[model samples]
Target chain A: MTTSSYVYYPGCALQHRSHAYEVSNQAVAKALGIELVELDDWNCCGATEYFSVKRLPAYALVARNLALAAQAGTEELVVPCSACFLNLHKTDSHMRQHPRLEQAVNEALEAGDLHYKPGSVRVRHLVEVIINDIGFERLGQLVRRPLYGLKLAAYYGCLIVRPDNVLDDVEQPMLLDRMIEALGAEAAPFSMKTACCGGHMTQISETTALEMIHRLVTNASVSEADAMVTICPMCQLNLDVYQDAANRMFETSYTMPVLFFTQVIGLALGLSLEALGFGQEFVSVEPLIEKIRDVPPARSKPERRPKQALPMPAMPQ
Target chain B: MNATRPPTFFDRVVAATPDGERLSQCLQCGTCGGSCPSAADMDYTPRELFAMTMAGLEEEVLASNTPWFCVSCYACTVRCPQEIPITDLMYTFKQMAIEAKRFEHRSTADWSESFVGFVEQRGRSFELGLATRYHLFHHPAQVFKMGALGLNMLRHNRLALRPKSIRGIEQLRAILDRAKVLAEKEAWR
Candidate 1:
């Protein structure tokens, strides 16, 4: 088996606002024996609006980072943020599809002395990497502190699962659910799994943004999950930092710690709260972590469904 | 003159609006109104506005201050059970309303102007220009405090004093012109 390692693109939010995500992601990956190589000269992903405002420059902004990743000789780029993953993936796809866009973007990149040919690098989400490459069996093996009795609401925010091309499934993505289950935690059956967590909309429109966040948090809280597990930094921020504001806006009392899946994985891997940057969250994970710590390891149960043989058709004489 | 004049229908307000997809998919769950941070201050809810627009109540849709009150947070769109592009629709409607001179919000106009200034000067949003323009427009006292911060940022080599323009300004102008024409066509109806 060829051992796979990936170049990690932590994007701007991970570097600044969601530093806990980077910390947890790195620690968990290290514990699992997967090497996460941080990209050397990565920049902002230009986000969702930049492309709409100015297409060529947005492509160039994303392409510059891709070119850097390619130059570093890494074929696979693993992005933890859904918005970054979408921006990077869309830029790559669009550049390959449209030669004019590619040329203009490359020309802009010339100033930075970086250039990338479209399709040269593959962009993969962290969830996809863990579910596909690491596999459930391997993940199961790495679980020293199995998250038994911990009910988790797997929140896959809009950017990752939208546009259909880069996402696993638009309507119902099971990747996060499966990963949570692999950690020995109960994945709460919630319908708002693929809902949008108002991205930078919090800055542009507070009322509208709060409403969006209120629904996601309310659903997760109502699901009775100890904490909401997410893959994207923006999703984590909107749900975590904005929870209080959203609650106040709605005049509803609700508290749910929003955490990156990596942090949960770190806890499951026997890493300490300090290692996972647990205390860094605005919505305290201390109480939830204590609950997680109390639970015993999950007991292996036999398969419920009986093995059935394929029915053969009777031949007519 | 009154009898000869053609009656303006509700659809006229909504006709040729750019963000029809967002308006069409609102689920009327009241999640938007319930969660909106500014809902206490604003008159109409995003859900209600969407309902009105979908019902083709154009004059009410355009004349109402709901669109201007939107902060563009993806919260509603994100939490939307139907996954409507509520913010995008607001942006489109706000732009249309401004072009028609039917509604005017000074803060929004200032924001748009600052954005345009940034793009025209540096081919991107420069922090200094944005901050200065915003403070100048809204609160001039903010300029002194921001000036101190700007100097500190410059000292740390964060803010670039000289703005950099893209290579093809003419091409950018042509694209902007095309977009303006499209906006005008959408607004007139």
Candidate 2:
């Protein structure tokens, strides 16, 4: 591992709607001998919406957390949530790129008696640290129970890999695939791996969001994957919470359980179900749990996505 | 710092954002429009929005539901051949529409407004509270539609009634206040 420990930022979602992600993440990290020191007094990331309403205040809102993380004096600040990671990474990049933004942001920070220098702290997604710093070999070694029979579809939601994709390829990222493989599961083929999960559109326009959700769930269902593994809380929430809504809208039944990569990793590392918060999912992973505990999926030839008439976009190495 | 509204909506948007000035580099490739998942529901596709922006349709651009409809998935911004920060541009447009108070999709705009208000007030979001306020004021029908889902989440403890305030909420408020001042000072009048 690059370093044994780093500062961790679990944004608001983790505290409420996505607490399971935090639970599983911490369990998995502990199992792997990683020390995640939570950031002190971090505020919301303003998510994807606030920035649109008040640009400067939103930057300050996102920047405040960075400023706090910088105070921790850790070289690496890890964020689990995709939105938080992007906000912090984007702020760091935007600040470094635009000195004026940095200056204005710092000026606001000064009001709270906080100081931050842009680019001083390395902002990273949690999965990147696990895959890169922790190394897949080491990760695979820590797999005590091995996710033997699970056919997993890795869903890399949009924020983590876009415009400035730091962790994975811009289009067809495979970091999640590699991480899932390290956990000893078959990384099932999924075409909508990098597709947007309609994000907050689920709240804005239900019909449109449901359509987008239907596409992702249908594609995953078509793949016959046991469950779709995700890194983002929003992606997991949208997929997990809105299955009924999606089914009602599209008249298609999709029972694909959306599990966080950490949750699955925790299971592979032999963490308890309660510790991993498995039962918290809206779409019960009970059937998948039966597979994990009693009868795991064998390495049988799982169903694959039919060859697309249109070729998928290529990713960088 | 002062009222310097550029004649064109595109120009105003570009001028408003320090980083989004690159919209002029657009190739009209329709990559943004094509990549957008919600484009079918939009009145003006991202490409058309850009065209209208460049055509100096100030009021039309400000009032267009395109910005409100944007889910900020960043799909268009990611695939833009010109490397334009289309998502951020959408944000810039959203702020402009809020200031102009002429949103085509008033309910959607109001939803975003209520959310932002929730975050600013408590330094965190209370999803249940925000939804109730927004639905009751804007689209009361949605409340009933989402009632079961809301109840389920509440029962599961996924949704919380009490808001979670950050430890140094006072500091957070101070930062937000200062930022608001800076934004007002720096925002194009």
Instruction: Please write out the lDDT profile of model 2 over residues A54-126, one tens digit for every residue.
Output: 8888888888888888777877899999998888888889889988888888888889998778888898899
Evaluated on chain A only, model 2 obtains a TM-score of 0.91
Q: Poorest 10 consecutive residues of model 1 chain A by lDDT?
A: A49-58
Off by over 4 Å in 2: A1-3, A292-317, B1-7, B187-189
TM-score of each: 0.66, 0.92
- In model 1, the runs with Cα more than 4 Å from the true position are A1-3, A293-317, B1-189
Writing each residue's lDDT as its tens digit, candidate 1 over A1-317 gives 34458899886656545677888888888787788888874555656544333334545657767888899998889999888888788778767866655666666666556678899999999888888888999898888988887889999877777553465776688888988998888888777887778765554455677888999888887878888999888788778777877889999887898889888888888898889876557777777767764555565464676568756798999
How big an interface RMSD has model 2?
Answer: 1.7
Candidate 1's residue-wise lDDT over B1-189, tens digit each? 478665343334334332343455556898877745455556689888777766767667766677666544345655677756565566555654654566335554455556555654444445456667676867676667557755654543444555545554444444344434443343322
Per-model CA lDDT versus the true structure: 0.69, 0.83
Q: Considering every candidate listed, which one attains the maximal lDDT? A: 2
In Å, residue A309's CA in model 1 sits off its true spot by 31
Going through the candidates in the order shown, the clash numbers are 15, 1
